[model samples]
Target chain A: MVATGTWITQPVAFTSYQVTLGRIALVGLVALGLTAVILMGELDLSVASTLAVAGVVMASIDNLALGIIAALVVGLLIGAANAFLVVVVGINSFIATLGMLFLLRGLAFVISDEEPVRLSNIDAGISFGKPLIGEFTPRILLFIFTFIVMHLFLTRVRVGREFYAVGGNRQAARDAGIPVRRRIFTGFMISGLVAAGSGVINALERTAADPTAGSTVLLSSFAAAIVGGILLNGGRGSVFGTLLGATSLGILQVALTLSVVQVDVQNIIIGSVLFIAVISDPNSIRAVSGSVRSFLRGGSVLSKPSVDPKEATNNG
Target chain B: MTSEASGEATTTSEAAARTADLGDRGGADPDIKRRKLHVLEQMANRGIFFFTAALVLIAALFIDGFASLENITDVFHRAAPIGIVAVGMTFVVISANYLDLSVVAQVATAAVVLIGVSNNSNIPMAIGLALLIALAYGIVNGVAVGVFKANAVIVTLSTTFIGLGLLRWASGGSIYFGPSDGPIRSFGTTEIGPFPLSMIVLVVIAIGLHFLLNRTTFGFLLKSYGSNRNATRLAGVNTALVVVGAFLISALGSTIGGFVLAAFSNTAVSAMSSGFDFEALAAIIVGGTSVFGGKGSVLRTLLGVVFVSVLTNIMVLSGLGFGYQQMAIGALIAAAVSVDALARRAAGK
Candidate 1:
């Protein structure tokens, strides 16, 4: 019975292997740019909106080739704006991205005129976007390519190391001759650009540009990032973990969906998983020996503050 | 004219004396400094929006029926539901521990529970039952975050889904109400002395919240924990209990808002409040409750509720549709939160 239990519990034995892989590829690609900003210890709430706008921009261009190009350029511009606000204007990442969220959502609505815009022919929409190049889903291909390039850039490039430095401790990074402001700005830009790309992809998949679509995903993204073990304090997590977090969450949701569970139960289950992950020490022995090992290659640690609410009240 | 209206409202209060401290930079007699900080704090969090000075200016100048007593009552009436919700949010926001996003879900769910239980009879009992359920739901939210030590964001968010799902199931996947079309309809419409009874409920909630936030030990404890929990614990406070208790209060706020809606809307609909949680959050943040932790006020939230209502009313009157309103509100919340952060960094607080 114990042997059977272990066999059933092992993820390898789980029939959701395909779903997990698919989610990992899709969500990982989307989370990559966000990983850049998070590494610098900043939160970008506007990425989802950026993605939506980029998707809409792609739709307008019509030609698939141009659509993809338009999405990237628009994403870059938005990213630049996000960076400018956070690094130069000194707005906190949260507020800055939030502002960007409004601006982008507004632009989307105004341009779309509060109407859903789509390619009239479904095949035309997917012919360019959905084709698998000899077996690899385009999204999967894009995901792999993005992950590889991003991993290389983050590890091998001069600027990539700077991202780590700034995120490690902004003050220390500054002291070590990093252009802290510039790096931080660059991080926000990446956040916007990546989200834009992802949003555009989402549009292509659904064949519609929805201005309001991104808002619902914001908290989930945060939950994923946190569960993947990225620290709000910064400098302690990896893109790999974030990707893993997204995949794990996405797959878990799919698995729940396949079961007869109600939406509330699904939510309860996912919420529990996220909560446990957030509070549990990242490097508990079981966790270390578990799947987290394959992702980061190193280890994890997070300290908790000791206090009861009443004592905290009295002190304040 | 807006100033005159305020002057009329505050002829008897000391709040009138402290109104313009914003102009007095570097006036740091601790008392004055505290007062100025208080005003600025209110502005950053929620008060500025509620002030209606801006609303009055626009309405007085741009709107044809702006200053009419009828319009005044209408605006207050509109502000009532949001005010009640905001009153509860102020408690949660100030506790600096948890944020309750499940109110819309509660309201929707409770609306269904109340109406369904009424079984086409004893509507008041149904409304009362809904209030009881709202209270129970609040306890659930309180327990999930407080006892579990869960991240309030995820917990509340999921709770929202849970509430929404429960509502759908209870209603059998359809909205189960029609025109409150009866005496209960007046719960939302009845007015007294050029003022709305709904607004009266809002005002009472606001005053009650203010006293709870400022004039009590529990309030002080919440503020203290919000500022620094570790230090608070070291000082011997039961930080968890305080947070739990804070959630309980937030739940009560949710119940009041939900119960009122149950009485007024007379129908419980699925996905009826899909956007409500976000709007409440936007209002709370716009009112100036830091998403991070610590520092906010009921008065500011009151202002926020009014500001949002008037802003919506004006935008609708001006004929800009819901799309622009959303965009504008997003901008407003972002701007409000940003300015608050900017002030904090400047003040080194």
Candidate 2:
């Protein structure tokens, strides 16, 4: 906020902060779900599609409560379908979800007839965008509440800890009787439910549902989870870290907007940031620091260029 | 204590050997029941071949004008660009490098660059510059994945975004259309004796890649490395070179495909080749290439490309809507991958 204020005097008003915060909360809901799936060593590329489908479903229905229920149901079904393909059919998660991503996006397009649906008349009796306390909106509060609950679920629950074990080593987890398949299935379901919630929130906030709503969310959510220190390989990261990561991204977007960076350039910046974060993972960081320290001490960093043959054998 | 320790070591070694054998046979056994399953798995692995034959027969019998030589030629011509790109994807996946999501972005970038640069410069110069740009992206992807040991998926995806963004920014979000009455346009639009030039180019590239993958030392090293990177490294192969080579091949394929597409369309746009990466990958997977790497043939990818093209042609002839067509493609990919996985599992691999 301070940096943004310093950068642009004309736009540095209280409303800017409120808008930015609201945007963060909206995107953070998707990131929260993504963090769990990543922790369980799976990728859900269909989240954006799911969000679109749910949002469309909500916007199309006449009754607000019924619309919300229908959207959640759609989300659960999609999640189950993804889980069935990946877990039951033995398809790789990446391939299965990639397929689902296209399939659901197509479904959304079909259902909405490629038009944005307006929900201005639904009268849900709740204003998600309205400020609940000072500058904080109901959406932001809901996002914060979700973060705390997910953090507890992951850190304090036994079943949640199994997500880590399964992701870290599936065979070992299976051998340890951890019910690896069930954990994976459940993780995907949770992702679906959260994605649905995100869709509903978006519809409520904007009073509209667009078929393309979730398209940009996928990249941004992945960016947040990765920047939050969540390993793409899974079995690591925390909900709190993800929150912080999402907040940082929100701040970065504000700063960029203040600086009047082009939208396309912002994409390039985000991509570069994602690349940097992945390469600067803990293992790489350690290796780089060690090499630097050794170089400073007059030691050869490239002395043993060859990795041990034994290590190679294990990988194959 | 020593006896117990020796016993534990023997058990662990036995387990390791069992797992290794499982991987080798892809979960198959010589028992009668297992042999039956093996046969089924073989048939499933070649499912695209059978499906394509069936679809062609059905189309020839039922659909109007489907059996015409001209329509057949058109399908092959259209399949050429996708086949070209799939050839490189075949190499990448077989080398265990997995998917390159940036191929579509590379294609779009190449198309735009070719048209934009050719507006002022000669055709050959534009082609060279476009290829050079594609090669640069490939090199960066190679370095990130091979040298830095970054995840292939994420690295390629990031590059995809970067490429798309940079291209859009450079073009100022405007479309580019090159001169229509040039040698490049003729190369794209011309046909010789009922065969499109693009199809001939695809066939030539396919043959060359087939030879390179099946009859060379480099091909052997690539497959060996993909199957077991550690083992190949232990054997003193330059694994990094192989990685770089795979990505370069893929990029080159994308460049060629982009050039042909741009020439055929007579225009270039930032979003021209969007979502094409999935199609190329689907063709590779459908062709019976194991996603785990160390196995695949460019020839098979060609067949897969033909199969997808024919399927889309049929759909269009049937007047299926775009939405339904997308759904079918998605379902086909999921089904193909599932069958592959099931076959592998049934083989005990």
Going through the candidates in order, their DockQ values are 0.23, 0.33
Report the lDDT tens digits of candidate 2 across residue range A180-229: 88888888888998999899888887888888888778777887888888
In candidate 1, position B172 carries an lDDT of 65
lDDT of model 2 at position A209: 88
Q: What's the true lDDT of residue B110 in model 1?
A: 61
> How would you encode candidate 1's per-residue C-alpha lDDT over A1-316 as one tens digit per residue?
2133234434542675655555556456557788888888787767777877887777776686788788888888988877876765466666567667766887787767777778444575576465477656566677778878778878899998789889888898888889998888777777777777777667777787776766646655766777777765568777777766776666666666666667666655555555455445343334334424433544212111222322332222
The Cα error of candidate 1 at residue A222, in Å, is 3.7
Q: Each candidate's fnat, in order? A: 0.28, 0.42
Model 1 chain B worst lDDT window (10 residues): B20-29
lDDT tens digits, residue span B1-349, model 2: 4454334334323432442333234312246453355654776555666666676667766776655656766776778778888887788888776689899889898888888889977777888788678669878887677656677777887888888999999989788887868887898779875468998888778767776776566677778878898787656565666777678788888888898888878889998887688788888877777777887777777767867877778887887766666777787788887877787788888
TM agreement with the true structure for every prediction: 0.80, 0.87
- Which DockQ value does candidate 2 get? 0.33
Q: Candidate 1 on B159-200: residue-level lDDT in tens?
A: 676566566655666666645465656676678855677777
Recovered share of real interface contacts in candidate 2? 0.42
Clash totals for all candidate models: 19, 8
